[model samples]
Target: MNKPLIAGLLTLALAGCASSQPDQPFSLTVAHINDTHSHFDPSDVQLTLNNKTVYTRVGGHPRLLSYANQLHQQAAQTEQPFLLLHAGDAWQGSGYFKLNEGAMNVDLLNQLPLDAMVLGNHEFDLNNQRLSDFIDGVTFPIVAANLDVSQDSDLQAVENLTPYVLYAFKGDKKKRVNSVEDAGKYPVVAIMGLVLEDMANIAPNIGQAQFKQELVSAQQTVDTLTEQGVKHIIALTHLGLDKDQQLAEQVNGIDVIVGGHSHSLLGDFSQLGWEKNAPYAQQFTNPDGLGISCVVQAGKFAQAMGELTVNFTLDGQVTDCKGTNTLLVDKVFYNDVRRADKHRLTDTEQERITGFLAKQPNVALVDEDPGLRTYIDETYRPELLQTYGAVIGHVPSSLQHVRVPVANQGSQVAPLVAASQLYWANTPEVRGVSGREVDFALVAAGAVRNNIEAGELKAGHVGLDILPFVNAVSLVSLTGREVAGLLLETINGAIGDDTHAGQFPYVSGLRYTFNETRRGHGYLANIEYLHQGEWQRIIPDARYQVVLTGYHASGNDGWHTLFEAQQAETDRIDLAYVQDELTAFLVSRLSKNEQGAIEVHYQKQALDCQLPGVSCNADAQAFIDYVQARRPILTALPESGVTVNRLH
Candidate 1:
């Protein structure tokens, strides 16, 4: 054979071998968002640098949509096979959900071209009927393989809900095939859904719906999909990041996982201008040591969109993957202003320019997407603005609602919430018995979502941020020893190593010193409580009634002792809705005078000190009075009472 002929034949032979290989690589792109929490309107978010609040105003739904659309368009231009997924929690958090019963969220979310979304715990917040209605309204599939909805007729009838879905992607149609039989070659992608197994414990509206263990459900799904000749499989999970990571390691065939629930922001930290964490596409070796699975989660509140480009072998194994959890910056306005400046500038344009210039001295001005801006203004802004303007009360100074143990003390907001709960628990109308008082009140740090900013506090702010959950305030009786044990357990389980724990105890009439360096039960020291107007060390056997949210009283968040104590009718007293109770408490304080002019008296007392200066009254009046008198200054409890001996 001639040299040219030999070379051509060799090339043809190599191509034929490559086509026959099962390990051939194919690429697919996944764009996802999670835990939006009904925050449709753009709100001010404090941007932090090195754990310091650098500036505010970072995200909005409009900008998020614009960024997602841009990514979709780019994928289309590149002719890349892509899928858009929402990992869940599309309900609750904002006033929009409360106003429209998640109708607005469903409507707005329907506008996005999503392939699928896993059911989040919050989806059950409105009960099965509404959840079924919301599911019916959506155009895309709502998948959750582990949810046993047979008991719920409405949920069982949801036509769009499924266990898993398969998406087929045909290879390049333009590529010439020598044989007609070989023309339809392509890869099939299968995605399975798993919800948090503890849904019923967190969202009671789930009722009889049961959730299977994530590992079991995921493994079974993967096995089924694999047996059906599907090589590439993904778990569209609503399990938080920690569970997702565990799932990745435990499951055999899960090629990738898009997760939510923990509201984790995964990816290159430096690019997002936030704390460092796992890369957007975090890889984990399968338990069998045969393959690798990747996991990604977009942060909550439309703050970022996770973009993952994954390549898989023909046999359905992940070969390569890359991408990031892209932050949706409000840079679109810069161009808008530039374009407007070239023409006759309108009043809005002038105002935008002025605001942009003002941020220039310390922070950079990033513009939001005009399309999202218009949507918020025309569709969502009217009611939201009214709520924002409806002033509930005035705060003399900013009450800092930091979640971390600032100076070894818990959040100021937590105590305020606890005090409110305690006040309601003592009221005959709320307590149901005349002249009854809870011995102490406890509020979880996570329950208090946002801080009361120094200024006019509005009803909308409270509804949208402060008291977002609809949990009822409940009272439970426990022995002083049990109470002390519950506190110790909370610190050990939830507040491990002195890191920020949402379950961290914030009390109205309890004081305890926490040793950060100590392990297990030893973390707590010098536990004390106010009894009969005196600071007294807790008597181990003394029975004391405690006021807290029903969620907490049920022994959720590692409080099994409290749960055991709340089983008795005499021990447990369920009060009114927590939001309504808190609102009534604030209203009561505000109505002290015709002008609603009331002073909040929050004494700067140490966490370990005996009810210092009589300011440890543990009532709404104390918080109200403190706010009325302390103008402009952020309230910090005196550090003397609760001291931290170890390095944080």
Candidate 2:
């Protein structure tokens, strides 16, 4: 796009420069996906078709691969440049990640023909070593200009890592490889990466690697890229949609942003009965008003992909842009995908839905990539089944996990998880050694990964589906004032920005009202604690033991107060892993009443139940025991109840 530079290169051949004619518009088709997690199988989605509410399965890696391959083949036939870019977050969420870690992800992702990918925060969940191994397995280059991994011992050896990728479009035939950028000839475009700088604050065990500020890194990278004669730029970012927009408005040279994080679906899905206000390939005018940057993101959990087509002028300006963010569906239909009896959709209904989907360009009914499907079915699928296929508890209703609760819609699972932690802490064995009872249990919303549906639950459902991170439990002693500080710190940290709301705390045996209008410590009021058969206000000077994940105890993910409270060695107690505590809590749920109904009595006062001679192994087995013990599982909040108020 640097016309003066291009004009001076009279010896340059225009073979791969979009088109042979000068001043012609260059068309680029970018099929992008972000926050895919590791769901290998199809995810069930309910839709209204032919005036009937019906269910069908959509997305998965195989389906995504199938559809993306088609797009690439079509682009090649048409002689247009096409790129499949992943914005980040390709780890965690399912049993595949739990059993195989990054190994399976590496193998499966190696099958996909992606040109480049960005590093997501979740990629650091295991450690720098695991991330390095994953990096070594993949064929695509990771474009992350903002992150400095030189300090991490394992990541230093990664060879494919780069600040950006340059595509010369056949202009430099001799220097075909991307790493050695043609210094003289102008490349068609440069794709770079920018992610959250405070990644260590959010993800656990990121090692010594550090990330630079998103906006600053982007501008610097763009400036550097432009200096090298690559005027057209695409920022492959993992900073979510809001930050992506901020980058576009602030950075002048970036012409496109394919982003992840925030898990936002951008595009019109109104034809499918929802989302008219969403932005798909939305273009924002640059700060200088000289050009525009187009942005797009796909939803989470391998559910969908965003396909964006942009026509760029010779000066790196977006002339026209269009795209779709849609779920790639298969033909299979079910009444309840989670339950044992799927209640397959009638043939007539499937036909009707198929006919309806055929009319919508924003959606696709696709098949799985045969190679990927065969590998998953034969290798990882059986391994997952062996580890996590047993049926656990049966949920009576759906419990959604909303990061920042809004009007009558708060997390129904976080409190349950908190209660589980309390039960695990109060177990006779654990409490006897510590000689202290846990007064309250608190959990961060970010830790709860998924929702619980009203159907059959599997062992892996909690271990892999919900709480996938291997964070250990921590028992910490803090004064009432300090406890309040931790709560407020998390509240304000996540307030207004849902992106950081993973730090928002959900508690058991505690209640408080948060008035957003107040300043400093005044935002929260009516702080109360559950005493013996009473709801009492917490004494400011009193010391109480609290249960929390080690991540939060160490003050990760905006829980600054928790970090400060545990400065001394005596201030903290390391218990079992959080997965262990949750699994044990499920076992405690087996406490029954004389009336033969499952007693819901795992509160502060109630005894943490244990089998006379049986010990439920942490993570999956305990959940299985509880589920098998109590059919059609039911749960309610604490007696005085958990209260979360945001009066803004």
lDDT of each: 0.65, 0.71
- Residue 525 of model 2 has an lDDT of 67
RMSD of 2: 9.1
TM-score of each: 0.68, 0.76
Tens digits of lDDT, candidate 1, 1-648: 000111343335334443222346778899898998887765443333333232233455766666666766687678676788999999987767877888887778876777789999889888888998898998778889998888877887778888887765533112222222232244557778999887766675986688988889888988887766667788999889999999989888888899999888875455224467776788999999989999999888876778898987666678887887766544322221112334334567546544643443212234556765777688877987775555545443345565546556556677667765665566656445423578778777777776564334555666456766556455566788888788777766654553336766777677777776644334666777777878788889988878887567667665666655543323354433232222222101101246633222112311221322222122333233333334223344443233334444
| Candidate 2 TM-score, C-alpha based | 0.76
Off by over 4 Å in 2: 1-22, 48-51, 170-187, 270-277, 339-342, 394-399, 406-408, 419-442, 446-456, 468-503, 508-511, 523-648
The TM-score leader among the candidates is 2
1-648 per-residue lDDT for model 2 (tens digits): 000122234225433233322345667778898998887777655565655655566788899889877886686567666778899999987778888889988887877778789999889888888898888878888989998889889887799788888765432121223422433333366789887888877788788888888888888988886675565689999998899999889988888999999888877776665456467888899899987999999987787988888888766578988988877988766655343345777788678778889888778889988878887999889988887766766564456678766764678777777766766666676676556688888889988888774455677787777776655566677799998888888877776643487888888777777766632223776677777757788888998888777567667777767655543333465444232333232111222258843333232322232534322233233233434653336344533233455454
Local distance difference test, candidate 2? 0.71
